[model samples]
Target: MDQNSARQMFENGAFLVVLDAPTGIEFGIDLDTWETGPLFKGLKMIPPGIHYIHYSVVNNDKQAGIQSGFLHSFVSKEVVVRRWCAETEQLYPSDHVSAEDVERIRMGIRDLDKGLGAYPLGSGPNDSYARWQKLTGYITPAMLAQLLPPNGEFSSATGSVYEDEEMEEAQKALHHATAEPPAALLDTTDRFNFTHSDIRRSFPANAPPEDIRKYSRDKSWLLKTLLSSRWHDNPQDLLGELQLAFVIIFVGQNFSGLEHWKFLMHLTLCCAEALEDRVLVSRLFVPLVRVLCVQLAECPQEFAASVLEQDNFIAVVLETLVLNVYECSADEMRTIMEKEIGGLRKLLEERFSWTLATGRQLQADADAEDGEYAPQVIHLD
Candidate 1:
């Protein structure tokens, strides 16, 4: 593009991102890979929207690679400076860039034009930005602030509670004997570590008295309690936080995040009435049920009722599935109901003597159809 066009674009607040990395490192933003120049500078006329930046480092063999990515929302004329840490094999954010360095780079974009790659707006939207948006559309800054790991920590470094639970008793005993309990555990008054009681503390102190009363250790009560809270005007705020937890698990590779996400999802499913009445929440019932189905199928004996619940929690899933089967009409919804939900119903019936009203209705319907088409018996036969 001509200098005049570039200057015009810059005036509209396009982003200039500078990456300080080894020459051969494969750097990319969204779906477009930058052709590595001397300084690895990317000057893109971003359309003032959310974007994802990703990179992978070639290992010593130049064959193996380690990948990391992040999401950011850009404003016009935003200059983001990041540096790749060869030692840690990670990328550091613009926080490390000195003001002078940023100013110098910002002032000299024209002079360094030869080294910078323009944003690939010509690239089809589907192949690049649109795909990234689809993957991350549910994630928002508020969700990130509440769910993303503090500082530079990712999910891998923070091992899950379930993971810690899985250690052999002997190994745990040995490790506990040698290790001092962390300071967080030693404190008597502060017990907020994502457990039942801990989750209650998430609500603002000024929340309504009725809302506060809803808190409980039972996983089934989680969604009910959350809905009762005055966290935001819309229920989706809480759901966005839940989605962040889920995304952190699957995308962030944080099993601990999944544990939390699943805990919440399980609880939400328990509230069968909400899945029927609330439009905001009913929409999520399908995905939540799908996850539960996969979890149950993958490990049939993995589930157990919450200690805090008065009756069998497994019955809750059964009740919800029955409700969903009768009410759900969408093709995707019916498909999941037939495949995952239907499988769960069968599992419950065979394993626990549980019965499905919907299953009986389906059988009745089929029997009625067969009777209608029954052939008259012939005496000659």
Candidate 2:
């Protein structure tokens, strides 16, 4: 940052005060991380916006434990305080501390300035702050409240076991017959309020058979339903949720986060009919393409190799989206669509060797072969 910018941030940026955190633990805010030192308090001069604060506990051997984090929206010159719980080995709001003590700490912040680190705000495209801003551009405070857990905490170790309502009738009956203890039934860990979607149940029960079949095949109706019910017809909110899910997966390293991301990809990419809505095409897909580009470019190689192998779920969805847009859009819209899609195609090919054109051609060949298969009648008839 330039001197003027640095001075502005120093005068106005928010503060994070972490109290009694152990030395050598991995601590991070946004994209920057550090191994804590003896005097480590927290970050200083953080830009006023949404940021992910995360950490991993370290063992005696210095190996890190499961990552955990939460999103916080900071304001100018605000001080947010958190204390380490030695028994639980986690960070929690410093509610138990007396107000006077906190006030004293706030008053003495300048004395502890040397213990704090400045937010990483380098002036470049690939800088930590810039990339983080791109990743979270659409995320709003309202979206965060709707999707995050009630306590605003996220941990890789936190997960939900099957609830009785979600269990099969047969399983419930068996459990009752065996008289399993309630404690053994499910873990008490909290889950994020991700919008629920099931492909099998995408179509409405009251729809006619033909309409149901059409809805199942097209998924446009499902997208509309979710837009109305879950996102309040705001496409940007849906995109915001997508950004949140990916951030959770990428930063928290949580498996449930990955599941949420996949469901959203299916919901957004499978809707060919949605492309007809100019508002959706411009407001959603335009930024959606940019979001996916950054995510795929920054995605870890192990994740690509393991979770999304060659011809994986993303490739299939991208193929469907490309074909649908080409077949459904008008001539004028194709230019903008092609530009965004072309950039995505180039990135995929360069990074993962995923050729969408080849995939589309192969799918066509397979469909043609299926069409050629028929039952024949001979002279016996």
Candidate 3:
């Protein structure tokens, strides 16, 4: 930006004040990261929006520690203050800071301006600012509150009680040997409110057996019920949750985030009926495909490899989605869906050497297999 525009933004933009953060620690907002210097305090001239603020503690050996972060919504000209807990190596709200001290610091903000870095806004659509917005477009502040921990923070190390139960015996023994038992420090009650773990039980408890069987075979009912009940009034929120889970996995590197993402992908792709809904097609699937494209493009190589592995959950679901769109959707919707799916296919082929068969190809393969497996008529009959 030019000097005049910079000055205008500086006057109107939000501010983040970090108190007592260790020098040399890694700090970042959105897609930009930097090593903290002696004079570093926080960020300034931040554009108003929802943003991911992440950091990693620098250990004695100068290696970065586990990544930790949280999502926050900033309003124009707002000031957000947080304090670093040296003992815990985490950032927390500065509620304990005295009112007079905070006021004194605010009054001296100009003196501290040199210590704060301006938020980076890249130059184009493919830049950090624009990409971050696209990745988080559907996410709202309310959704963050519902999904994040009670402390409103997430970390690579975050785990649930259920995860603890699933841990290997050797891992449990290792944790027991530590001075501070990780499990003991963990908040057992803290868990993300993703969709139900079991799609088979998505139906009501008292529902008829046939209804249960139908729901098991086709998740259209489950999809509709979740939209009406959990994400009521806006179908877009479903996409929002999916985006949120992906960001959590991509940025936070949290395992639970991956599980949540997988569950949502299955739920979305299996719902053939949703392909027929105009509102859902436009608001959910269209943007969802775009989001997935970006995510797949930017995801780590290991993650991409896992997705492309033979018969993997994501790969299988994507194939199912293609078949559903081709067979069940109207011509106009199918055209749109095919165009989007084509882009995804191209990306997969270019990046991973994985080919996703078209709907016709899949059908042809199934037909050939059936013919090969067909029983011959008996001459006696």
- TM-score top scorer: 2
Query: 1 or 2, which is superior by TM-score?
Result: 2
Please give the lDDT score at residue 160 for candidate 3: 48
Which number leads on lDDT? 3
| TM-score of every candidate relative to the true structure | 0.57, 0.89, 0.86
What is the Å distance of residue 260 in model 1 from its true position? 3.9
Candidate 2: Cα lDDT at 340: 89
lDDT agreement with native, every candidate: 0.53, 0.79, 0.79
Each model's number of backbone clashes?
Answer: 2, 0, 0
Write candidate 2's Cα lDDT for 1-381 as tens digits. 788988788779998888886788899998888899998988899999999999998889989898877788889988878888888878886575668878888888787788888998888899999999988988998777777764467888655222323544556677788986433434344667777777657788799999888778678888888989988999888888888888887777776666667778888887777778788889887788889998888777777777655448887788777777777656656556768889998998898777767435745765776677534447774
Q: How far in Å is the alpha carbon of 339 misplaced in model 1?
A: 16
Could you give me the TM-score of model 1 versus the true structure?
A: 0.57
lDDT winner between candidates 1 and 3: 3
Which pairs, if any, clash in model 3? none
Determine which window of 10 residues in candidate 1 has minimal summed lDDT.
183-192
What clash count does candidate 2 reach?
0
